[model samples]
Target: MCAPKGAAALYVRDGLRLEPVVHGGGQEHGVRAGTENVALAVALGAAGLAADDLADGAPARIAALRDELHQRLAAAPPGCVRLNRPERKRLPNTLNVSIDDALGHELRAAAHGIAASTGSACHRGNHTPFDLARSLGALRLSLGRWSTADDIETTADAAIKSATER
Candidate 1:
């Protein structure tokens, strides 16, 4: 609930008069009127302010942890785990991989504490074409502000073990 991205700010271009899908007696002079989630709006504003105050190096640090996790997982025997895309093109905090001889959902279940989903996060956004049409042997790992080196180590070990189980 603390994550306020669900309903946040909206930007309309200058000289653009857009029509709202829902027209009712509401806020903003009744232009697309609806009851707003006041609490969520306040939390979103607070989160934005907090984000602006974050250290410039925070993203880089998280990316480093992401890279380290990939490296540790890659140390597994060749072909056991495959990086689906080059890191340079992806969001620094998301890693997408496919395990040999195993399905993505299976890997997810076997990895235990790791929280992830089958295929890449891109799959949900239509960025990946092969996941649904084939074996679905893809996994997406997301790292964030709270991720630590120990978390990376544990994740890598668990994923490798799960993949190598064959």
Candidate 2:
């Protein structure tokens, strides 16, 4: 399902030159020069249409569930659970957090019913294997159209329980 050549489009303001991040490519003003992939573009458009077909209130419902989970998890002691990217606008379907004194393994084991993942992308590839050793408290939770209130409650309970273990 991967896109061929990995197509991407950028909008640069007139007269504004955004230096190429990875120089040397003889195409698109010296970028990852490659032949156009019409099939890939069609697949991407189909995926976009599929996403747009979700229920009208699906996004709002997902956001409410995310917020509920956040509230439940953050009800712990001050400084216990910290939200990632708090100062910036975040997607309504995702909630990432780091809980103080919580081991990644501990949380994982306790949260058997929740499909939560530990460690953030920003912490990975820093010469660390999964970055779980250092980011033991981090948990990247994603809410989807199928997620329910009960799932959110269970997730929060598991996280809070694990966080309190240490």
Provide the lDDT at 43 for model 2.
Answer: 69
Candidate 1 stretches with Cα past 4 Å from truth are: 53-55, 120-135
Relative to the true structure, candidate 2 has a C-alpha RMSD (angstroms) of 5.8
Tens digits of per-residue lDDT, candidate 2, 55-162, equal: 466667888899889889888766577776563477878887877767666777787688777755676666554445446667889887678898998888877776
TM-score of each model, paired residue for residue: 0.82, 0.60
Residue range with the least summed lDDT across 10 consecutive positions in model 1: 126-135
TM-score of 1: 0.82
Q: Pull out the clashing pairs in model 2.
A: none
Q: Rate residue 62 of model 2 by lDDT.
A: 84
lDDT values for all models: 0.76, 0.71
Worst 10-residue lDDT window, candidate 2: 1-10
Clashing pairs in 1: none
